[model samples]
Target: MMSSCAHPLHGKSVETQHKTAATTSQQEKALADIAAETQTTQPAPVAQNPLLDGLPASDIAGVQADAKRIYSNHWGPVSERSRYVRARILPILKDMGAPRQLEVVPVAESGYNPYAFSPVGATGLWQVMPGTARMLGMNAAKGYDPRRHVEESTRGGVQYLQEMYAMFGNWPTAFAAYHRGPGNMTRRLAQHPWKPQDGLDTMPVPPVTMTYVRGILGLSALVQRGLWTFPEPWETHQVSIEGPIDVNQLAEAAQIDPEELYRFNPGLNHSQYLDSQIVLHVPESMLQPLLANAGQAAPEYVHAKVRKGDNLSVIARRYHTSVHDLKRINPDLSTLLQPGQTLLVPAGHMDSTSPPLNPLLAQGRRIHYRVRNGDNLWNIAKRFGTTPAAIARANSIKSDKTLHPGDRLWLLARARTS
Candidate 1:
């Protein structure tokens, strides 16, 4: 968040945005959730072991590939971020009786940036909307967002996650619920049978939520193998003071540069004092120095969570940044934008006049399919770079209905990339 560009966010940011956790057919998912026709006894999304349990070999392979892709491109910079907050997060999860692997959730959420705020209004490491934050007992009102405080937000996130695990009985579904939102997940679950035989990855979740879960697992696995490393981390240290304190004076007392100080304290919107005795987050090293004078640490990266219709060029222009810079930071970002994906960028002076992206313009393109002789769902799926199940689900194909020459089997509606 730059002094010139950081705009005050106004509402709930959707993760899963575009309130944005949409699966194949929200209508059907909703109907299934309400109808008795949905599956009743689904197997756990992840079996007893969170990592190795219910995922198929092919799915694991896909996750591994994505892990390597994201890791190879993003690990260097983001690793520093994850490592910096490692000390603070590990103890919190451990105290709450959560698996350490689960810690990767925040890393994937916002690159461990407490100042990470989405345009849609999601904030903090968990990327929770204000409504959800308030519901979870965190005050998100102006001048009093506990979500900006790492420790407080971490507790809220952990509690929510623990609850999700209890409800879903597995990590995959729990993680999905975290991103997909519980209600959306419930609706999605209504459509999916707990098929342990097919594995959790095969479940027809929104692509973004599915990716979110896989990345968490991938990071956890990579960490377990000693392949991931973060070093010489610095984190913010908070001190409550009586009345608004001059950021300049505080920065001087803490023996820190003004820019660095501001960087550490995203809560302080200006260099001057304004709040009546707010807690200030300064560098831990600055804490003792700051206390000597009556003080300090800092972490934040400016980023935008990709919306359904956003493209690199569009996102870059909106932030007053160039596409090359975005690509430089996000080397693995696909040409197509997927909701819930986060892309880092320079938080330099933002231009407010930028137009919002229009999903209406990008709404799925139509591709008609008149069945040819000898063609099957599997063959059609392979040709279209999709799945037979996806095509079947899209068309609502009856189990007994068979395809024949000249028969019409429409391909799934999808966002246009090309």
Candidate 2:
């Protein structure tokens, strides 16, 4: 224990320490070299635009591809359509607190054409389906498909999108639901839970949905980045009209080309006559003239004298109107019918089986009336302010039995013209 001389074991221990230190240094240097090589070979992360909101950076490639496609292949027509509708649509989105970029939806769905109808019955600028349109308070019935109305359909589509967003909690998922349907998407999402980090690429949706999502995102991105710009919008104003008016007459009154008027009011293209009261869109410049013409138009309601055995239902059926509408017009009306008591009734047309209430009450300027379903001489004369005998005489009609739909008849002008 007290030996002064270095033992042989001590020298071996020092030599072993030195050899261990040298091996550790060599391993550290090799690790550093490997780290440098790896850094040099790896690609940099892609820079994402903040406006993409819920999309992940991994979607960049697909989004860019779609954006490029739109620019190259769809720019001209898409831009034109976008320019036309942005004025009408953007305000709605703004009022609803929705994203402004939603304007691109019409561009993708219908190229902003109000008349665009899908083979599956999706219609209007937003391409809403008939069932969906009906649920949104649009009249998608046989004679009037309001889904072809630009403002109505856009509101319906945006409301649907908003509902989807509420359900999914994000735009991408909401968009997927919009395409695939809420029920189907809910089922799919139940099977494969959505992960925001992984984005849509990893979602269990069809390729078409994926493409649709990417295209919408791409278009929105382009707008956000100023790579795409909507041109100045055409100015328009709305005029509320009591209708069943001729398109040509309306166009003439507004001093606008009939085709241009049709372009502004494409939803009425199903028939030449606008069959009900509607807020009609027109060029701003034509608004004043249209207003003036509307002022001079015939009254939509006419006075009727309650007669023996006459009831609200009977009168409503006689005029092709409803008791509800009759009550709405005559607020003080009671259930009891008092002969010689007056009530305001809608000056609506009567069908073949129903006789005119008071044919003599018609008093206004003459108009060209196209015979519609269930039209008879008495009802036609009552509608156009002429007597049944006068109509028969002018048109050379032998009897009311000879009248048919699509028959053109000229009614004699009323004694007191407007």
Alpha-carbon lDDT, every model: 0.56, 0.58
- Predicted structure 1, TM vs. truth: 0.54
Estimate, for each residue in 1-418, the C-alpha lDDT of model 2 and write its tens digit.
0001100000010000101111245445643443353354442212223224544443543575576675547667667755545677778776765666677767666666655533233446676654565566655332334665566666777787777777776677777777778888899989998854455678778877777777777777666545567788777887777755544555666677766665565565322233456566776777888777764444455556777898999888877789999899999889898876677776555122211221121223344666778778876654343568777887777655567787777765431110
- Deviation (Å) of 273 in candidate 2: 3.8
Worst 10 residues of 1 by lDDT: 1-10
True lDDT of residue 90, candidate 2? 76
- TM-score of every prediction relative to native: 0.54, 0.56
228-280 in candidate 1: lDDT tens per residue?
55565565676776533455566666667765654454333333333245566
How far does residue 49 in candidate 2 sit from its true spot (Å)?
8.3
**Residue 160 displacement (Å), model 1:** 1.7
